[model samples]
Target: MTVSVAHGTARLSAVAGATAGDAYVRAREALTAAGLSEDDIVQVVEYVTDPAAGCGEARPAGVTVSTVAVEGLPEPGATVAVEVTAYRGGGERIATGSGVVTVADEIVYVPGILPADLSAGFREQYRSCLEVAGELLKAAGLGLDALVQTTDYTATATRAEYPHCGRPRRELLGGTGADGRPVHPGAAGILVDRPLTEGAMVSLDAIASRRPLRTVNPGWRRYETLTYKPGIAAGNTLFMSGFGALEPATQRAIFDGDLLAQAEYTYAAIAAVLREARLAGNAVVRLVEYVTPAGIADYDKVAEIRAKYFGGPVALTSVVCSALLRPEFLIEVVPTAVFP
Candidate 1:
């Protein structure tokens, strides 16, 4: 087990099979070990067996649902999983990029996100996230053009299944300009996955700055914005929104039903986003990963991925739980890129 803490965030990488209740207690313990408090911890991420499935009558005790996605992983059974990431201090210093987007000015969550009924998934989930991102930009008086980076999440999107999901995403955020003009492409990163749910294909989180778009990338293969966020904040510091393990082209999950593959795609996407943002792999200074119980056994693999890409000494946290959008998505990644 390795733990690192910095910038008001705590990262714990451990290999232990624990139930939901146990993972909750361990989260508190990890916080205490880092000299942090529960109140200071804004979110709780965990990887535990599905309380409703594997545990069944033997479900752990005292696990209150602050946030939960019960069916967000591989088949519910004895699966070893690795997880990493977190947002500390209620994510105060790290302002919501969506909060600053001028165009996406509101946060609306449609409870019944039916993948089959994409209107709800797109309008309420996909479009709503962009709306929030746009709102964040709008609050800062910057149009959607000011945005340089973005990350998306979905619970159960596959290549065959994502086209239907991407339809609304493309229409709403595909190429619309800040002034309501049509652009060639839109958004920075689109990550989706498969979890246990019906028609819950999208749940996105993003990070951007009120700063100006200064850096530009010559490599124009990317369909979306070359920059991840607008402006260079206090030097080239890149704060990323939460991302997951979906194949970029189809917008479907790459891992199928594997946490390891999920983590790999996630790290790969982070690396791609960093490079696209003109930052190095090591620029990943902070990470917050969401995991499910099915992935708890392979905790080492998550650490390995971080160590491989981010190197040693970056702050990370692994939370055991479900994704808001899909049930089979075992991992979702949130990263911060900082340059020297």
Candidate 2:
């Protein structure tokens, strides 16, 4: 499948906001400080406490947007946190003007899509989400059968039900291998204690491309039966799956209770993927850190750890959440590396 292209990444959570407009202004200010303007933005990711409360506002011109209602933002009292992926250089880009973006001869990024029936059951909500992605891509002359990556945001109350949602995902993202196995995307799932829209159980942000993909596993066989790859390489870009400090062999969390230790293991794993993909740490353009409440106090120290792994500047974001897929997973990371 395909995924989003990233030349650069930036975090907007550093800006404190009392309102959506205030957050937007503060975000613009922060971008200016970083030497990036709105014209460079390719995508916008916003996290809010309530979607039905109108917490999300307009984003930069010609950018794809993904707004999810989560537990909280990085800044206290901030109603929303925004993150952006900017176009730094080197790619044939196309914004379909309908939330679908593509890198010609590479991959396609389908904008944020959720089920139309917010009150539906988990299965229905999930199927509809993928269906929406399929429809949107269809309008842009693409197909969802090539979906290579996805980020699912589900209501925390339905935690146990997410695994089952995979059933619908497989049914819709249909590309069975010759071995009779399902072709799964490199997926990342997060749980939210509070949803922006009342009764909205799930929402999704996905990417797909008809281009060929090479799996970058770093010898992690545990992903063979999973719905995602450790990393997927499309042309010169690598889309890495969300990873914590878990040991793939035993399925046990490593360096438990220590945020820095966990982050180290996580970054090492990421490094392994880069090495296998023939990329260097410097190739990474974005990092999205999902930190649980337990790790927030220690989150500031993570930048130093990140520096040890990535050789250059990165668009980084650290978002605090009530909990992760597992309580022991104090932090999880998803990164995109672009080859220069």
List RMSD in Å for every model shown.
Answer: 8.7, 4.4
RMSD of 2: 4.4
In TM-score terms, candidate 1 sits at: 0.51
Assess every candidate by TM-score: 0.51, 0.85
User: Over the stretch 58-139, how does candidate 1's per-residue lDDT look in tens digits?
Assistant: 2222221112233333334423223323334433322332211111111111111122334464445555555555555544
The lDDT, on a scale of 0 to 1, for candidate 2 is 0.72
lDDT scores for all predictions? 0.45, 0.72
Candidate 1: global Cα-lDDT? 0.45
